[model samples]
Target chain A: MIHINEQQVSLSGEHSIAELAEKFKPDSDIFIVNGYPADRLTTVSDGDRCVFIKKGETPAPEEFQAMLTARHTPGIQEKIRKARVAVLGLGGLGSAVAAALAKIGIGKMLLSDYDVVEPSNLNRQQYFTDQIGMLKTRALRENLLRMNPFLTLELIEEELTENSLPSFFHDVDVLVECFDSSQMKAATLRSVLTRMTKVSYIGSSGMAGYASNNSIVTKMLQPGIYMVGDDISEARPGQGLMAPRVGIAAHHQANQVLRLIVGEEERRRDEHTA
Target chain B: MNILLNGQEKECTDGSTVLELLASLKLTPESVVVEHNHEILQPEAYTAAELAENDQVEIIRFVGGG
Candidate 1:
């Protein structure tokens, strides 16, 4: 049986997060909730919602994971397996991001990048020497599949323009912005801000430089817009970037995506306490 | 010329470095992103760097985000 905070309720077929929020009023201060690890409020199974409660009322990580895993209804698993995510770059940051998402069993991934894998990218990007000269999307597809055979990865080997933004934003739960070029990053952000509403989260990664210590900061831009990077560090116009710094930034980006997948409100509340 | 610390432009002694300006404004290095002359200025270089005349600086505070 399904319930929202002790009141019994039933969700029919597929529904948007808006619909669920409208019906349940789950945003209330006292409403404890859980489910949809990737998207807590979007749509979830009976079992997932059963465990949700007020912000500080939850169980420990081990206990919670056990409950969610043990009660893994086919419906919830199917939802996770069918989710579509779009990654907007394939550089050091995007490459590692796509790999982490793939490992977590995200059903389908749309890898977008028009650039070719260069020797310079090997230090941080997951691509191999054999992948040189290949389009980044192609390389990511092959690499992701190797990580998880069950994943369905797609490729869009083109620069994102105003015209392409509409179709690209369609049906995706989240968008990962990993462009290296500052101009391109700004353009993509401008277009997405104007183009779509289906995009629940747009995670943007900024300068992840060679310095390991000073190059990691994660800022939540808005409800769904997050900017991950040192935001403070930079490479001199002609300087080179290394692996560890970019990898740390990439890892932070992936962590935000996971937090969005689970419950952003909960995460925000926790951040406040910390 | 007067330059803003956050939003208020206060007079400062000549040859003030970014670090000195930050101190004058009572701002911490960890809490702001400085933009000077239309470019995003890196925090690490802010200390060794000096401010110039007619320069407009935008200091944005860092907030927690996901």
Candidate 2:
């Protein structure tokens, strides 16, 4: 028996993906096995999972949505679609975090950044050359929408402060701290931890310079607070923040956000109890 | 009195406030966050918060890029 798009079928002999597509979906000329595209001649065995794509056809919006759901757990895509995440600061870390969360089908996102995109930001930030003069929040919104049109995004083009952070955190489920300055990060954490104790926060620190990737790590700072990156390295006049390391730290933050929304911690606790 | 500053032993003036310690280290109050004995010191409290001997202080500053 082989699974095709979550459905199982009994097979008598070895069959090529093409033959299976023809038998199961006569109109589809392309086949995908376990998320990877396969040629028609690719052979499949028992227990193989397959999905058929129509010939010469790009996935429609609905098809793309289906693909996302097929890749994740049964109800995770829907949970992500209903959750609201706020990314503060549209710099290297923030841009990557926002893009990652959006691609995973997060229902709503609040993007905040006061600065416009500069050419220097292209090194690590997720923005285009055409958006050089546009606000970072606006550019990020456009980029995310292009990937997931159904995403709901709220753009804030102002600097965040202690007084203003609460309003943004009002309805947000997760708050991502992506500020460039250490003082700002501390201020934001202080405000969020003190004022909005219920909201989850994922932050990055010490993600600078071309250091060993192993140095980057994610730690649960406290309940509802997760921090990623090394705690020692800092960007200085000579040493600068590079794309690879920044992307690593940003993805760590993004992953933590997803885990929180999916109740991964709770699942682990349940597993331990059992 | 001597205290641990970022893991290094440093001699601080007796009864020195966090702001004074930052000034002695040539670090601006706006650029660094101070944690006194594992508790993060708020910016407003830096001036009045006093330091005791053997206090474990951590000074953290942000990198401007990214």
Candidate 3:
């Protein structure tokens, strides 16, 4: 018996993936077994989960392997693949963080940004020259989809307001704060933390200039609030935001989100004892 | 009396409120979130909430840039 897309199929003997595809999805030319893309010549055994892919489809082999490698134990990859995250910005930090999360196989992401990509943003933001005139929400969604077509992105092309925050936070498990101004960041955090008390918040602060990479760190500000960055650096007239530092902080936020999704701390403790 | 503020022991006048603590620290009440003894204090309660000896306090402010 072989499991095809979680459904078991009784087989008389060992068969190639192509043979099974011919029997099951005869119209398809591609097959995936247990997450990796398998050619028809690859053999399928008992209990194998086989899936058919349409022609011209981009098989997310890298993403599949990433999910498998991310697992500390069985089913942990599914946990990461199912978790939903909301990112409230699409600038230097938000864009990179979203990309990293997509690569890590996050199931869904809700992106909120009202600005358009500017020529100045090319210095440090995750956008190309062609995307300069496009709305950040649209550009970011397009970019993320290109990287991982399986990632579900809910794009909100409006500034976050008191009434809108609740709606955006409705189903997401984690809220990522990536606003560029302090006032907006403060307001967003206050509104979300006070209203949506259960959602985890990961924010970036003080990622500016060419500061020492070690200065960028994650701080547990409160029970569900985690801040990443140096906590002191700021973009000034002379010293502006750079790509490297912003990317560092963005990854810090992304890494923390991954940890929260997979329960990395608890898993670490479990591993130490065993 | 001595109280732990963001994990550091700080001496404060007895019967001081959270507002007074913020004043001493020179932090704007609207710009920071305060937690007293692990319980987050609503912004409106800052003026009336008093700090006791040995009470732990955490004050966090938003920083700019993504």
Number of clashing residue pairs in every model? 13, 1, 0
Q: What is the DockQ of each candidate?
A: 0.05, 0.33, 0.39
User: Which candidate number would show the highest lDDT if scored against the true structure?
Assistant: 2
Tens digits of lDDT, candidate 1, A8-104? 5666555444455556655433323453233444555554353333455444443333343434544554455566778888887789888888866
lDDT of each: 0.62, 0.80, 0.78
Question: What is the Å distance of residue A42 in model 3 from its true position?
Answer: 8.9
Best by TM-score: 2
A163-241 per-residue lDDT for model 2 (tens digits): 6898877568888989888767777776665567567888777888888999989877456677788876777777777
Which docking category, incorrect, acceptable, medium or high, applies to candidate 2? acceptable
What's model 2's overall lDDT? 0.80
Q: What level of docking quality does candidate 1 show?
A: incorrect
Q: Write the per-residue lDDT of candidate 3 for residues A96-200, one digit (tens) a residue.
A: 999999876788899989999999998888788999899998998888878877787888987777446977785577888888887677666666665676678
CA shift of A105, model 2, Å: 1.5
Candidate 3 wrong stretches, greater than 4 Å: A1-57, A60-74, A162-164, A266-274, B1-3, B12-30, B36-56
lDDT of 3: 0.78
Indicate the residue-level lDDT of A35 in model 1: 37
RMSD of each: 14.4, 5.3, 5.9
